[model samples]
Target: METTMLPAIVQVLPGDDFTVYAYCNDGAVRLLDAKPLLELGGIFESLKDPAFFRERLTVMNDTVAWDIKGNRDETCCIDLDPCVIFRTAPIVDDPLENVI
Candidate 1:
């Protein structure tokens, strides 16, 4: 029998065009496109601002999240499920490979 482990997000980097680079525990960098979600309106309205989006990007609840209020309040912020991201997002090259 084999056991499967889900990847956990360790870091997040906001990219241009509403994309996010999620670094996972399994050594994978996944790219998440947030443009469609931002266009949904409602709670996501605050994320439409590119500056706010990049500034607030963070890791919360063990996943890619936004500390919208800057308080680190998990419940008040927006977060994406790690499993969803690991499964749905395509693995991408680390954007900081040359920087660090």
Candidate 2:
């Protein structure tokens, strides 16, 4: 199956449960859990620090990214592919919906 890349991430909101609320340019929202990735270690190890993990999230290169360099250098940055994230992340209901 051919897979197309999802829209760029416009916003990323961190949650208490190691999940992130990602808003895409296409008007889709998804909840992504980082726990599994964090367990793989390596660069992801730095995310073990809750404060650093939650506060350093950013949207870069059309995907979810983190600036671990503290200086905003690309060298210490990590990003997840939007296509993959869109496919794997759980879909979230739009809170703006009005219910009677």
Candidate 3:
């Protein structure tokens, strides 16, 4: 029998197009396209602003999150499920790999 552990997000980098690079505990860098969620409106509406999206991007509650209130309160922030991101987002080369 085999058991799989859910992925834990360690860091996140937001792209201008609403994509997020989620770096997980398993050493996987997955890319998440957040446009779909933004289309849903409501609380996610605030993230439509590119500046706000990138500025508020953070890792909280073990996943990619948007700290809209500028506070690290998990309950007050919007977060994505790490499991879903791990399963759906394709693994990509680390964007920071070539940084000096």
Candidate 4:
């Protein structure tokens, strides 16, 4: 028997501060911070450039992906696992916190 995978990403919206809001097929929205991942270096190094990072964000194969070449190929593509993304904590902003 084979296990079934969860719903894929339906949409991705890139935000400032290297954050992305992802909407999944499961009817869930998740927030992912790329700051930490960018610190890991390697292929992620290229993403340190905010412009490059934001411009290439896209939803592919039910996951959040970035294709450096914009060709949608495996070689220059970087993706975040949908399962892990779904489990990530969402970013919440409290407007009242700024009030004194």
Query: TM-score for every candidate vs. truth?
Result: 0.91, 0.82, 0.92, 0.79
Full-model lDDT, candidate 4: 0.78
**Off by more than 4 A, model 3:** 1-3
User: What does the lDDT read for residue 45 in candidate 4?
Assistant: 92
Over 1-100, each residue of candidate 1 has an lDDT whose tens digit, in order, gives 9988776899999888999999999999999999988989998998999898999999999999989889999998899889899889999999999995
Question: What's the distance in Å from true for residue 56, model 1?
Answer: 0.7
The RMSD (Cα, Å) of candidate 3 is 1.4
C-alpha lDDT score of every prediction, in listed order: 0.92, 0.81, 0.91, 0.78
Tens digit of lDDT per residue, candidate 3, span 1-100?
9998778999999865889999999998988999999999998999899999999999999999999799888899999888899889999999999999
Report the error of model 2 at residue 26, Å.
1.4
Question: Model 4 Cα displacement at 60 (Å)?
Answer: 1.8
Instruction: Show where candidate 2 strays beyond 4 Å.
Output: 1-6, 94-100
Model 1 segments beyond 4 Å from truth?
A: none
Write the residue-wise lDDT of candidate 2 on 22-71 in tens digits: 88877888889999989999989888888888888887776788888766
Best by TM-score: 3
Clashes (candidate 4): 1
